[model samples]
Target: MSPARSDRTRRPVDLRQRSTMAGEASAAEAEVEMALDAPPDPQAAAFFDVDNTVIQGASIFHFARGLHRRKFFTTRDLASAAWKQLLFRVVGSEDPEHVAEARASALAFIKGHTVAEVEALGEEIFDEAMAARVWPGTKALAQLHLDQGQRVWLVTAAPVELASIIARRLGLTGALGTVAEHEDGVYTGRLVGEMLHGPAKAEAVLALATRESLDLSRCTAYSDSINDLPMLSLVGEAVAINPDARLRAHARDAGWRIRDYRTGRKAAWAGVRLGAAAGAVAGAAAVGAALRRKR
Candidate 1:
């Protein structure tokens, strides 16, 4: 053989060395993938409603109170807000007209306001007013789900900023709430979509489950009003917390669990009556004055 051919024949193939390097590269690639993506939790989540479900009263009532204290609007404005809140608490969020009016009012209230400023105010107000009012039973249930390595998400029709503050204070995973549109940092007096209510909540949860690769059959949902029936039915476990009369009846008929944290039905009704009366009185006076001024 020629000298070049002899040299090529003398070169030995290091198969073991080549294999080791290839294996190392594959292992490194897998490590990088593992670092990039987290494994999805096999366990499911628990969704909790705010307002009468987690707390004793409407959350927006507290928020409005805070805004009124800060002079974000006048007492007349507060009266209008109080009237809307009373309707929400008494009649529930089922009326489309009321819903539209509430949406318009909320949009106008936050119009031109900085999102960060509103969120900061919400957090401060929550700590001062809403924190101490959380129902021990509902809160314990939420903690139980957390202890079980399941995620707990607050589902509400409230603003996302307020919902986030509540979830963070309670050490929950996150929240799904109504999205108010904003430009730069200020609210544009518009919503990105429909308010997170009724069927919208179920849709939001379904989307969340799909995104997280969750098994809806293992999830739980809790709510207080009949309007949330769609959301409650979407879950494997449905719990009615401080349910209204309609919801209580529906829960009984559907064989869902019911938790009434109120001391007594009569007392609860009495409290609602008192609040409604106060709001009506203030609202009537404000409307009367406004009409007189117009004339």
Candidate 2:
């Protein structure tokens, strides 16, 4: 037989042997996967995207808004929301760039504050932003994770300390957020961890799954933004809650659950009304001074 003919015959047999081994491995894995996926305990995990998911808008933007109400923030604070709202409005939708700009500018506002002050302000913002707009269904879904003894993690690109404070106030189980480098009491404006959004979010979820011994095949995730698609798809169940349009379309295509939490109710306006009342009193004082000056 020719040398080339012999080589071809040997290659076919080797290929068959490799294919057989691979088929066996795949079959074993299929068995294990079937077992792991077997009616995963009515227990389920729920991941929340922090910004627009749990709160009315971006959390840090709301922080800036509250600061604006306090009338002490720089123009950069308003600039945070300006470009975003304008872009989203003009296009009749949101783009990832606008969302990211809002996040970056909002976190930039953290560069100068002492940790204690940030914590205090974070608490205050939680009272205002979350009090009036926290979706009840979202919290209830969180409770469901707790009842199932599954993990309830707040996933966001905000600073970890800020996210944790918000979680504790909301009675959540855990938090996974952007980690801005910090010294004793002030931010260094550098990130300690990867930005916890988009593909980074999915990586965080996987890391948590491995650390916590979770089965991703039995996990669930919730978010409102299309940016969360990476993490949402990592789970067996992806729930699109109060979702934006892009996410809604993706969820529909994937046959995921899409829920609406917007009751069109912005009730229980907490620190907000307090801020407003304070403003009204100040306005009255300024008007009285103007009248006296005219007289």
lDDT of each: 0.66, 0.57
Could you tell me every candidate's TM-score relative to the true structure? Answer: 0.75, 0.65
Provide the lDDT at 232 for model 2.
90
lDDT per residue as tens, model 1, 1-295: 9997765554323222322332222212111111133435545888998877887676766765665565555667667656764564346455544555555555644556577876776788898889998999999999998777777888876766677788888888777776767789887767655556666677677767776667898999999778788889989999999887788899999999999887867657757544533342232123222223222
Local error of candidate 1 at residue 14 (angstroms) = 70
Ten residues in a row with the worst lDDT in model 2?
A: 26-35
lDDT computed for candidate 1: 0.66
Highest-TM-score candidate: 1
CA lDDT, candidate 1, residue 287? 24
Number of the top lDDT candidate: 1
